[model samples]
Target: MNDFELLFDPIREHYRTTFSRIERLVNRRKNYSIDDAYINLSIVESKELSSKEENFHSDANYTTFEEIYGTKRPIEIEQLFNDNRERLLVLGRAGIGKTTFCQYIVCQWASGKLFQQFKCILWIRFRFLNDTRYPKKSNNEQYTLTEVVENECFSNKLTDDGLAVLQFILGEVRQAVSNSLPTILILLDGYDELSVCEHLQNLIDSLMKSPYQILTSRPYNTDDLKYDAQMEIIGFTNDNIEKYVNNFFTSNEPQKSKQLLTFLESKPSIYGIGHIPITLELICSTYGEENKQHAITSGTTITITTVYSKIIEWLCRRYLEKFCNCDKRHLNLKDRSEIIEDCSEILDVIGSIAFKAMEKSSLILDKTLVEKELRKVSPKRPSELRKKLLNIGVVKSLTAGDDSTNVEAAKDYYFIHLSFQEFFAARYLVNVLQNPKRKCYTKAINFIQYEKYNQRFLLVFTFTSGLLSGNDSLSCLETFWKAMTSEPLDLIGPRHIQLIIRCLEEAGSDHRIPQRSLWIEHISKWVECAANDTRDHKPLQTDSLAPN
Candidate 1:
């Protein structure tokens, strides 16, 4: 049996004994006592036995005790019952298993295995409570979180008054506690999600003072927690990641298993980031079946951006086919080339300006500068587009305080999540530069050539594509090639020129381009050097001299 199983044995026995005694007492007066009297009597009698008091709070309901501890084994039950108040806080990047860990703890506690030493377990999902539409609730019912908790505490109890059911639960809990049977353990998960609510501070204060309580939250702006112990879930270490990968691969396809591992190793930033188990599972499971063979044969990194891009691509393609086909529902919509051009121009301008700020300068530009640059294109709010960028994880939003108005600090709005930015930039570049039948290319070429624009665009494009691996495919290269060749390479410089040639070479003999052989000789020396060190910087002159 597991450690948790053994720890539960005594608690289980105690509960059994308590139930037997309560049953015996009820049997003796079954006929004489009225239903209400019996209810009160049983509650009163339960208080005397102290069946609930022994460890109700220690039962591990609301808090994610196990995840916070980073273990599955049962901890010494006595340790949690420490008299001094300590706090544990969990912090990590987005989509890095914070919430999942919290849930795992709830499952353990609910099972009555690990935290059985606690008298009562209470679990709360702060988001659900905070999200309740207070405006629609009864005018007479203004409730603090504590008041709400007091009500929910008695939800499972027997109560004659519907409005006072929660109070009844609390009463039962109090009576249970007064008996000094089991210690109570309260687990509060996603404190960050709730802490934003006006009532949350008060609720936290109440919890801190309570004899039994634990809380979990995101690390941002969540400093003060009077928890008995402070535990931060820093995510899986490299060993933990390897262990999880090994476990995951045992039953999965060999190719998908290999692909995910390759993906994990390719990017330094996302090494342990994707190992959140949820993200890894989502990426592998979503893309694994369809491309299992390809993934196995070709080493590819699965980045959060690439995963999101795949989903978006599928969505766009589906909608495009559905709305505008040769057959049914073809809304003979006027070819609003100008509108498309306008939108493309806006995106291009923003991409160019943002690229300059992110790539060329040593000093990072603030949001105000970014906004100023964007204003040159159109007066429309850039915040929405910025939000879209953040949503897709291309550029993360950083804040000084937890409040919204804080300007992004240094390295704040970068394309470190290369795959996601590639998805956006590649799409935007194609629409702007590769439209075969439009005047957009002429304007785009002119725009790109204007005053150090090439350097900015190149930096933007390269840094954004660095994180892409197998799944990114050759799409970005094709898009870039099409853009570069449409105009003279001299305007853009040799680096972009070689970039185009390199893409053509990698595109292989399938495309039947004579330019591949012609340029390969010109680029061979630099290419040979790059073969040894892919990240080594090459001179712009080398790029210009290398054919084209």
Candidate 2:
């Protein structure tokens, strides 16, 4: 075999096995390929004017382009990658298909369908690298590209001959690099997930000068790095959303898929979230499992928070059923009432973990930490509980080593999506508000005040507001005003102020706030304080200020 083929063959086989195995929903029997369920999303040039900061608004602005432009033309994913050649950076919001785009590139390169200009492609995930604790020594003993490849791609199946072949291939790659040949394409995924490592920084610096490389990160600006070309992953268009929903439901239930399309067409608010692929999947899975007759017969309006709440409920129900049916059944509830309680417990435990992780700005949970946390909640087997979570797609395993090592030692876990993590974190906070004995109200208040949680600030606030507003016995207005005003006015940021205004807007004109003018007077005081404290404060939107 040629040196390129020698290096590419195993890498292709490795990723093909890893990427193709995808599970769609909680109770689904069949798995789909990455390409089968993939919706081809279009990308636009990352203009300075089109950055995320411009899009941040009180109403949860997640658009890709500015409002002045009607629509800029989009380029195909491959064209965007190929156009940039060596140094390309892909930026997107959380769950907007950045990771999936990286996977698609790797899959395409592995199949020999794209990037024919390069001899080898290296796929590196910073999440794993950061978790693995790389750079064992501070000196020049940094990991080589070959070591990374062997560890990530071929560590499980490498034989003595395979090791020798890898060494030879590494030598060939070094020779190609020194000869100034276009021989490598490095795919660096999830830069934001990594801890601050100087070695990683140096490696990124070297890759910037390499012949071919591409990097993906959630939308954030940093002075530490520069790129030749940058593109943002704009999510699905209306047509693409329709196509994705059709693909998602066609195999299992065609009629239900049609009904889902109809239902989404009727509800613009929920339909807007369908433009995001992850939220789109959650919608399909939740709607598919719903009793269609009841949904068709009921007259209730479905909001975004309701959609996520139903998803969580569905996941918990599916998990409980599966656990009861398993051989080591710990939860043997008799009726719906018992099951409901059990489901709440499950969500509480999982939500607590998710909340703690988000506070620390981390995603992956070490198995040991998971066990420690689970011990306080459930005396029953924590591993079994974790397995149930894995089965339901709440948390997924990130297995590192081969089957020889203990699974706990070789594996880490994280929520399936950052959105889900935020949802559960909000759930945890809501539970705290509902029950004071949990005694973490101070922590929750501090969490909301911190700037690190600003990315998910709107989501958590909205969910908490929805929960409070839905309960008749609870005085949502009183509770909300007290919770928001507890912190000093000067300490509150503009995002928090905007969030409060949005929540009051949702509460409507007739909400039981005693007097609308009084509540507005309090909010005006907070806004005035915010304005005086920060020079960058912008006026709150008129719509959000309206009582209705």
- Score each candidate by Cα lDDT: 0.40, 0.62
> How would you encode candidate 1's per-residue C-alpha lDDT over 320-422 as one tens digit per residue?
3443242323322313233233234444644554444433331223455566655665568755545433433224453221223554322144442323333
Per-residue CA lDDT of model 2 for 1-548, tens digit only, reads 76546656878887777775556645447566777656677677745543223423222434322331234456676676554456887777666688788777777777778776667777877666653445356465666555566776653656676766565554534564456443677788887666555565665555446556778877654335677777767677778878887877757688877887887778665666676677777777767764522322133545455666667656656665565563224333343345546666566777888878766666777666677667777667776666655766678777654433556534668877667777788777777766555578767656654532354355666666655565564543455545554444424244444555555554434366444566577568755755474445554443333333
Model 2, residue 206: distance off in Å is 5.2
For lDDT, the strongest prediction is: 2
Report the number of backbone clashes for model 2. 0
Among all windows of 10 consecutive residues in model 2, the one with the lowest summed lDDT is: 50-59
Off by over 4 Å in 2: 25-28, 48-60, 63-70, 81-85, 132-145, 155-177, 196-211, 221-225, 290-301, 325-340, 379-384, 402-411, 456-462, 471-548
What is the Cα-based lDDT of residue 185 in candidate 1? 56
